[model samples]
Target: MEECCRLGLAKSIGVSNYSCAKLSTLLQNATILPAVNRVELNVAWQQQKLIEFCKDKGIHVCAFSPLGAYGFHWGTNAVMDSPILKDIATAKDKTVAQVALRWVREQGAFPIVRSLNKERMRQNLQIFDWELTDEEVRRIRQIPQQRACTWKEVVSPDGQYKSLEELWDGEI
Candidate 1:
């Protein structure tokens, strides 16, 4: 896919949920670097190390579940429920979701969010117009970090990822 993208057969190429180790291995042999990496990233589950690694590699990080995937079976509403985010949103006169998305955008990652309601979708799109302040960004960085979307079922003694640690390359 990377080669095809480079050859103009495709517009772009990317990977999803890839760890630093996997990306390094791909980089070792790839003829063309990946254009993007889509992953679960949010205030509560910020993939800081992965973001930095991708940035250094010239790979754009596309954030999935930037608001923490609330209400999903495998997700929690940690980012949405965060008091610090709430405060920031209130101070900025924006929604919590908007605040969260803005933070990801400030980190140079593209946020991929979903909202079924027309008004809600419009609200999500408003993130581009405004920006989060440096102090707000600093406060957001202080929020407790936790991986909310760990795919534990994929890791087993008989599976390719023998342990959860191996699945994330100790990133969890």
Candidate 2:
């Protein structure tokens, strides 16, 4: 990959599902640091330490499943149905989704939101117009966190990770 970058065949390199521990190990032996670390992040499941570490390493953090992947089998409605987020949405006159994505943005990570509906897609971009107050951010930080995508059912028995703890390197 470094050779590809040097030859201008690949502009940069990015990684997904990389925990801080994994990134630390990779950084030690890798020639060039990663340009981005894409991971599951949202208001409820905020990965603060990972984000801060990426920031310190000059690697941009890209948040995937920012809406909690609500309807998927491995996903949960935790972010969308949160009472705290609902309350904030009501007070802010914005949808819960907007608040969640805005929270992700305020965390200094780029949030990846997916929606097939055009109106829903448009609403996702509406978060930039407003900001969450310090009190709001504090309350959000206290929300109960649960790993929506545990990767339990998908992992092979012979795979490197035998359990969720191993898969996330205890980061979860």
* Cα lDDT listed for each candidate: 0.90, 0.90
What is the Cα-based lDDT of residue 71 in candidate 2? 91
Looking at candidate 2, the ten consecutive residues that score lowest on lDDT are: 148-157
Q: Which residue runs does candidate 1 get wrong by more than 4 Å?
A: 6-8
- What is every candidate's alpha-carbon RMSD to the true fold? 1.4, 1.2
Stretches of candidate 2 above 4 Å error? 154-157
TM-score of 1: 0.94
Candidate 2 lDDT tens digits, 40-116: 99876899999999999999999999999999987889999999999999999999999999999999999988888
Looking at model 1, the pairs that clash are: none
